[model samples]
Target: MKNHYCVIMSGGIGSRFWPASRSSYPKQFLDFFGTGRSLIQQTFDRIKKIVPVENIFVVTNQRYNELTLEQLPELKPEQILLEPCRRNTAPCIAYAAHHIHAINPNASMVVAPSDHLILKEDEFLNSLSNGLDFVSKHDVLLTLGIKPNRPETGYGYIQASHQSLDGFTKVKAFTEKPNLELAKVFLESGDFYW
Candidate 1:
């Protein structure tokens, strides 16, 4: 449906990536694995299958406006929202939400980062379809997550209720990058998702 929209967040400078990812050209714009398509382009190709090209928007820093166009020429200049300064994720999401909501009052949006690499396309898209359907029907905030499948300390973990309402678990608490011991505790409890 035209009411379905996607907002791709691509404003980060990606300093952690260092040599490969510079301020001028961050990781999102680089073809990390020789995929021909850059990370952001890969992200766009996946989302465009579900959301209309016109309905999809990219939120990036003002400096990357031209770079975004160079990479995603299908999107009109207006579809790219440029931030004069970096205000991080919350503000960036709010900015995109305000614009999308104003254009279509009934718009259902999926806000995603530009750097995530998902290997299973069919499964991811299927889950995305379900999440979008669930969000469109109710006035609620929804996010996709997978149960901890590996030992990792860098991911943020969400503790969800044992019960499920309408096929969605209620998030009880969130722990961002817990220590190794805490991560093990979550892995054992079996109620946390990363």
Candidate 2:
């Protein structure tokens, strides 16, 4: 826990899931599953098992600062990295990574979305542990890819190379929101994952 850091990205407006999710109060602040805890709270809870409470950070827009605070009251103000404007997940992650690296150069961080559902807790943690272990000893950027159970056109696809190291395949390419036909081909290839 000393060197482990978790960054939860919670700046999305969730326009697709509107009505239940709005700009003022995004989906991360709502319990979409009616599980008592909001999405951000659930994400924080899961990551806290592996990361210390103080080491966890939330990256959100300045507008959503109050919402983030309301959802995650345990976090200090500094733990919440507020972006001046919405620049998507890449910039948010980069900001969090820079902040964490400045504090602890040896830190290995996990950047995750605030609104995601993980039903298999044990498996998820085990995979995360494996990835962390792999990265600790190697100079590489590791990303966990989920094997597609269906032709999911909504999510981007990662094409894996033939080589495998520490149970992780090299990402050959990334395809974004492919058409239905291309999605079917990816599913049948047995090499792509969402």
Candidate 3:
């Protein structure tokens, strides 16, 4: 099978992270996990193992181009995509997808946040491989949805379908950030998370 590609989106302001994530230094460049490596560097290295280093792209704002390059030296300057303005995730992703498709039409791209915490390396890679394999054979949008843990009102949630085949859960609907009560119900129901 052809190798998959990964796009690390690090242009976010990270308002929730607060004072720790300043305008000069965003959360993606912070060592949130205390793993010695910054989030952006960790993300770049993690995807490198699965995808060719050249195939991995870092999409960010024009201002942070130098910071992204300094953190991820493995990535070429050209590989770091820069956005002229901040619109939203959808537009950023759409622009990136189109740019990448123009270069490699067969590429299977995985869009991931630069600040997420992944404890299980093997499991994460396995899931990614599955997504790539699925995308290669079928024309579908692949997303890795995590299960919810507690009644947390911070993150959004995705509802998975009843059908379960080949260890992949189907997505039903995506729920925006909910109130504490609704979040508690979601957690107790044991449906999904992100």
Off by more than 4 A, model 1: none
**Tens-digit lDDT track of model 1 for 38-95:** 9999999999888889999999988999999999999999999997689998899999
Per-model RMSD to reference: 1.2, 1.1, 1.7
Judged by lDDT against the true structure, how good is candidate 1?
0.91
The lowest-lDDT stretch of 10 consecutive residues in candidate 1 is: 143-152
> How many clashing residue pairs are found in candidate 3?
0
- Arranged by TM-score with the best first, the candidates are 2, 1, 3
* Model 2 agreement with the true structure over 1-194: per-residue lDDT tens digits: 68888899988998888888888888888898888999999999998888899999999988888878888999998999998788897888899999999999988888889999999987998888787778877888888888898898899999999998867789999999999999999999999989
Clashing pairs in 2: none
Model 1: lDDT of residue 175 = 90
Candidate 3 stretches with Cα past 4 Å from truth are: 1-3
lDDT of 3 by residue, 4-117 (tens): 788899898777778999878889999987789998888887887788888888889988999999998888998988988888788888878988898889989999889887
